[model samples]
Target: MIESTTVLVVGGGATGTGIARDLSLRGVDVTLVDRDGLSSGTSGRSHGLLHSGARYAESDRVGAEECIEENTVLRSIAGECIRDTGGLFVQLEEDDPEYFEEKRAACEAIGIETALLDADEARERVPDLTPDVERAMWVPDGAIYPSRLGAANAADAEEHGGTIYPHAPLEAVSVVDGRITEATLGGTVERTIEPEHVVNAAGAWAGQVAALAGVEVTMAPSRGVMVSVAYDELDPVLNRCRDPADGDIVVPHADEAVLGTTSVPVSDPDDYEKAAWEVETSIEECAKLLPPVADAPTVREWWGVRPLYAPDEAEGDRRGISRGYFVLDHADDGVENVTSIVGGKLTTYRQMAETTADHVCESLGVDADCETATRKLPGADDADRLDELVDRYDGQGPTDKDVIAQ
Candidate 1:
């Protein structure tokens, strides 16, 4: 038997679930499917540091502004899914002082709250901080539990009458005459789906999904490693106040600290070289900021692929690619009813979904304003309930494996 929905959303990560919740709240019928489970892709494999916009303040002004705005909104609505641990961009003795000043000035210019802390003052906040830290700038950065966040969004969408299918992979898509007529989903929910609109939020695999519909989405995915070590003393997310490089950030958790990451682009997101150097280098660099993590006893390590969109020709260092999200209307490429949302950070998933939902709603002529920003997700305030939803949706991932029991 064939099924149908007003909207078919691919991928069950934060962004896909966010879109489902947004559209469902607006009286839209939505069906979301994931090849694996919620957050099983890039969303679930992150170091899970909630950005405070300070990291990108110097480089991308507009991206930083969007991050700060969404960071504030998530703190309000995400509840237990987020931790208000604050963030510190430390300038070590070996680091550039001018770069530190530049970031501080950029944050101030963009209205991102920040405070300059001397080495003595910074050590007072986090005693485990390296004494090599010459100074530090404090921002509103925090920690995020992606499993809980993804589950809450999925639960909210389900409450609003949206259908969610975990372990349901989109096997094929039928695009006829500039429109997507049908989509064939495999795995547990093997069936044919007729949809009025299709959203490809498949993260790193977005290019593959788009090709199923005969659309081209240039994705420049890079691999990064997150090493979680057994450390309980760190109180805030630590960012190296210099150029964006491997092991620049450390995200603290209940009994662990996640060290991340190295950027090396790959031709295929699914299959890439998992070099030992990536993991070794991340731990070595992160240990500079928090020296104790060097011997903290590694708990577990996982690699996450960044779902970066490169519409233009390939260039040097994939790190130069923008982390900003883009909502692509495939109609420009000949498919009218298919859209792809690509290249965004986990911190801005809600905004990414809001933008994609708005475009899809407009294309479908559904006159409805977005309510996701204001409406708190289901299970937002309850950790147990959120974990239960995570299990229900099979949303557990290595990013928060320690936080949420499988």
Candidate 2:
């Protein structure tokens, strides 16, 4: 037997759920499916930093501006899913002072809001900070709990008459005359779905998913390791005030700090080398910023794959790739009814969804405005309720497993 829906969204990460919720709120019938569960992909495996735009202020002006705009929006609507712990870009004595100055100036130019702090002030704020901390710049960065965020979006989507199926993976797709007519899914949803429109929000696996429809969407995935260590006193997110490098970010949790990560290109997101050096290097580098983390016992470790889009299979370091997102209207690739959204950070997921939903609306000629920016996610103000939503949707991820209810 075959089921039908107005839209079938592939991938149940933050972007997928956000898109479903946005469209459903706009009165569109939607069905969302994931291979495992909500946020079981990159969304659930990130360092969980709510970007303040300061990280990219020095290099990508447009991306940084988008981040700050969305950052403020999420803080307003996400509620308990975010920790308003603020953030600091710490510069060590051995680090380049000119780079730190450039970042600070860039933040000011981009209106991200910043405050320069001396070594004494920095130490006072985070006493565990290394003695080499020459100075620091405080930004509005915070920690985000992706499990709650994804589950909340899914719950909101379902409430608006959308269907969500976890543990349902898209196994086959049939295209007829430049349109995806039906999709055969495996796992719990062992049947075929006839969707008027299909959205591939598969993140790192976007390229592979697009191929199923005879369309090409290039992806350059990279693996990074995040090691959560036992610690309790850190109050703010710590960032290395240098260029974007491995172990440059440390996100605080309830009783641990997630030290991360190293970027190494991989041909396939699912198959990659999980090297011990990456873990060792992350700890060694992050320990420079917070001395106590050097000896802190390791609680857990996991790896996440970045969904980096490569048009020409770009060369050089993978970190040079932009963190911005792309909403591909696959009509250009001869698949009119299918669209793929890829290559974005978790911080800007809602905006990514809004944009994709706008594109989908245009294709379907549905006149609806996106309200996700203003509509607070279901259970946004209650942590326990959010965790229940997570449990209901199986949206728990390693990044927030410690913070959320056990």
Candidate 3:
């Protein structure tokens, strides 16, 4: 099947979905295509943490502000996707207290609320936390539900005249006159698509997508492993209150706690092996904050890569690189008629989309302003009403209602 669209958005992860939703709401004819179902990539595997901008306080002030702003917007626009589980930055017996103080001060300066909670009070709120917890501070922003956000975006896009092509991987790219004209998808059911403008939002495999279009994108697909402890292990997001390094933060999902993430730089995004060592290391690291979790049963494990990027010509390892999205306008990069929104975090996906859509719209001569932000997405208001969709399917089980993140 061959199709044409005014704007073709590639990748169905957070960034891609956000762009599709924004462009579609602007009344543009948009088509979002992904190799697999939405969040089958990194966005699906991430610890559902709605960052309060504290993690980047010491290093990236700009990112911190952006995190706070987006966190607030998502709470409303994607309300069902988030819970105000109030995050707690725990200070261990040996960890530096000064760092905690600095984090608190920095977050407050940027209008991010932070309150010191005594160890007793902290344990009172979240009884599951280890009693040995020395101290903790409450950050007013933090929550989870990546799958909900992705679904909400897809629904919003559909409501505004957008199409999503899932399980449809791009196989080839055809260019004419230094511009992309057609794209092919592989599988038992093959397909093709032609678009006036294309946005490369592929996460880890972004490089491969760019190559298909005769352009080079140097993206380091660093794999990180996460473990899901099926327990209310922590009441709030438990941060180590230091530089982000290896399995430090434990994010709480619906009925489980997700302790992540060991960064292992990989050569391919398709590689998904949760190494025993990675799992062991994450448990060991999480124990540093709450020893009780050392005995908690791990219900599930997952691995996903962060799509870190650098210049196509230079290489400096993905770990040491800064954390932010890189929006490269193809015209400025000499790749004409294409733009790549690479890197960045789930928290800043909306901003990333707004930026990418601006560039894509410019190329297509579309004057639509971005509305992904400042607008409420579907299911953001109530999860129960959205649950009615399951009934729409003739009494399908809850799990069958939506193939979403658990």
Candidate 4:
């Protein structure tokens, strides 16, 4: 059968859902499709760090700036999806004091709030922290729930008249005379979709999706492995005060503390191999930050592939690539009405979507300003609603009935 829409968004990760919500709010007929469910890729596999941009302040100033901006925005609009637990970057006795000073200076230059904490204060905050820690710097980082954030975006999109189809993978792109006309989606339910525009937000698999449309996009898929421990040893996100490297961060997610990760370039997005060394290295390295984690029970482990973008001229390895995203107009490559966005982290998905949506709207002559920044997603006001529920329940714990209303 044949379906039609004003826009077809491939890849139902954070970026794609954000775009669908943005375009739909602007009165566009949008359809989003994904090979798996929302956040089934890198989005769900991440350490869920809602970055304060402090991590990249020195290495990638632009990326750090973007992260800090988006971090504030997400905290405002997506409060329910965030834990708001602050982060700490600790300097061990052997680490570089000069680099620690540089990180603080860079963070201050970018307007990211930084507070230095002495060893006693740092250890008081995180009792499990290694005794050898020299000092610490606090940043406004938080833990984010990927599933909740993506679901909120998807829900808001649907409320605004957008359609989402999970498990529908794009099999082929039907292009004629250098313009995209339709896309073939293959799954249990097959259909050909004729879209006025196609957006590739396929995350790590963006390169493969672009190839289906006969356009070449170079994407370096870097795999990172995360190991989950059974206990939440620290309330704040912990980071090693050094350059970006494997297993430098430990994020507290719900009751578990997630220790991660290793960045190794890979050829396939689906090649999520959990090497024994990677897991061992993560525990050993993260143990330097929190000693309890070394002996904690490892409950689970998984791997995520980052959609690193390095054009031919761009230098350095995957770690050196900027976390900033790219919105490629295939028209520049001789394919019309198709745009592919890649290379951003979850913290800046909304901004990435806004940028891509702006380009798409301009190309189609749609005159609508982006309202996603200020608009609240579905259930975003649930905290207020929960307060009302509390009053209705006379300050007692909410019963199943009251919870259902929310």
Candidate 5:
């Protein structure tokens, strides 16, 4: 039996769910497939710091602007899923002050407010901050959640009447006469999925997915390792006040804190192992910014792969490549009746969805515009009110406390 749909979103992370929700709300038939549970990839393993665009200020202006814009949008819609703990960037005495100054000015020009805080005041808020830290710039848009963006997007897609297939991997892209027709399930799951517009939102696995389609997607895949700590509050999210390198960020999640991460290009994404030297190196490095982190309880360690896309040879400067999105019309590239959305951040999933949906609609000749922006996702409306309740309540039972809280 061949089932057909308007689109196939090929990842279970923030991006795929967001695209499914967007297309479904536009009155399009959409199916979302994933190789594992929701957020099974880099989305679940991230540092959980909602970017304020400050991280990209010195290096990538376009990426910075997109982050700032999406940061505002997600905060407005996914308020309950977020904790507005705010963010701080600390520059150590040994770190270059000029780069810090450049980041501050770039943020200012891009509408990301950067407030310089006194070292003592910074210490007062984040007591663990190293005394050697000479400067701090606070950005107000920082948010942290126990889990990242997957939940909200998943809930939204389901409520919009979209079908979500977890644990289904794409074995191959089935195309006929230079147009994509469908994708076969990778493993024998006793069921198959046939989607019209197949989206390759597979983060680190994007290049592999493209390979199945007989195309090439070149993303600079980099691996990052993170160390998790139990208990102890750190103010908002603490960043190294420089472009993201290794062990430069401390993101507080739930009752615990996570100190991360080291970035280096890798040939494989599933290489999840901790080098004693690497964790020790991270702890030592984090200690430079936050003295106690050198001694902070080391509860757990994990790694993630970020899908960094370089400009196509057919394209020009990578800096000019829009951070917004790349909606490849499969028809224009040899394959017809298919589209792929790839390379963006979890913070900007909504905008990415809108762009992809517009392109899909154009391909399918649909007239309706996307309504994902206006609708409140399921449980999202309950997010703000259910915060403390869900924190204390069990994941299983129903209680009046939950009802009254919402």
Candidate 6:
């Protein structure tokens, strides 16, 4: 038997779930499918930093602007999935001062609020910070629970009458007359879906999905590794003030701190290998920020492949590629009724979804303004109300972490 829906969304990460929720909220019949569980790919493995746009402020102005805008929106509507720990960009004695000035200028240009902190003030907030740190800049960065965020979007999508299918990998995409008519499911469960529209939100694997439809989409799949230390010394996110590079970010989570990541191009997203040297390098580099990290026990280590996209002729290292995303309408490539959204960071997932959904709605002649930007997600209501609840309970009630985890 074959099931039918108005839209079939492939991929179950944050972007995919965000798209599902947005479309369903607009009264569209949507079905979201994933090869594994929700957030089983890059979304689940991210370091979960809610970027304040400082990291890319100097290197990529557009990315920085998008991040800051999305950061404000997410914090307002997805408070339940984020911990407002703030963030700091520390510059050590050996780091370049001129670049720090440039970063500050860029932040200012992009409307990201930043406060310069002298070494003493920075150390006072994070005593574990290396004494060699010359100064720091404070931003509104925070830690997020990507899995919970994705789950919340999925829950809201389901509540709005959308169907979600996990562990359902696409086997074959049947296109007739330059349009997608049906898609077959493979793996443990077998089924078929026919939809008027198809959206590929497969993240790093989006290129592969487009190929299944007999079209080509070039994507640079870059792998990054992150290590989790058993100690939690910093309350705010720590970043080295400089251009984008590996081992420059450290995030404090529930009870531990996570140090990461290295960007290197890879051919196969699922076949890349994680080296021990990468793990050692991340620890050694992060230790420069927090001295205690040099000897801290590493409890876990993992890696995620970024679905980085560039034009076919674009050339450079993976890090040089823009963090911005693209929404491809296959009609331009002579194929109709299908679109693919790729690239961008977890911090801007909602905006990416809204943009893609707007295109989808336009194609289907459905007129609906996006409500996700203002609508409260499943567990996220009013930020002030949540804080009041926390204050009323204090040490006498379940912590915010416990509530979010549930």
List lDDT for all candidates, in order: 0.93, 0.94, 0.77, 0.84, 0.69, 0.85
Q: Model 5: clashing residue pairs? A: 179-336
Error of 5 at 64 (Å): 1.2
Candidate 3 local accuracy as lDDT? 0.77
CA RMSD of all predictions: 0.9, 0.8, 3.4, 5.7, 5.2, 5.0
Error of 6 at 404 (Å): 7.0
Model 6 C-alpha lDDT per residue in residues 1-406, reported as the tens digit of each score: 6999999999988899899999999999999888877777888777888999999998889999999999999988897678899999999999999999999999998899999999999999899999998999999999877766777788788889998876789889888899989999875458899999999999989989999999888898888888888786679999998777878899988767888889878888889888888898889998888878878887778888888888663345778888899999999886799999999999999999999999999999999889999998876654444433323212111112323333
Q: What is the lDDT of residue 293 in candidate 4?
A: 92
- Model 2 spans > 4 angstroms off: none
Candidate with more favorable, higher lDDT: 1 or 3? 1
What's the C-alpha lDDT at position 321 in model 2? 93
Write one digit per residue (lDDT tens) for candidate 5, span 1-406: 4667778888877777778888877777887777766666766666666888888876778878888887877777775666677888898888889989998999999999878888898888888778887879999656544232455566556667777776677777677777677677753343555666677888877878877877777765666677776646676788897655678877776555677777666666766455676677777777787777666677667777766666453233233333445666656667776666767776777788888888878877989977766666556656543343233211111111122234
Q: Which runs of model 6 end up more than 4 angstroms from their true locations? A: 313-316, 381-406
Q: Each model's TM-score? A: 0.99, 0.99, 0.91, 0.93, 0.87, 0.93
lDDT of 2 by residue, 80-143 (tens): 9999999999999889999999999999999999999999999999998999999999999999
Worst 10 residues of 5 by lDDT: 393-402
lDDT of 2 at 315: 56
> Which number leads on lDDT?
2
Model 6 scores a C-alpha lDDT of 0.85
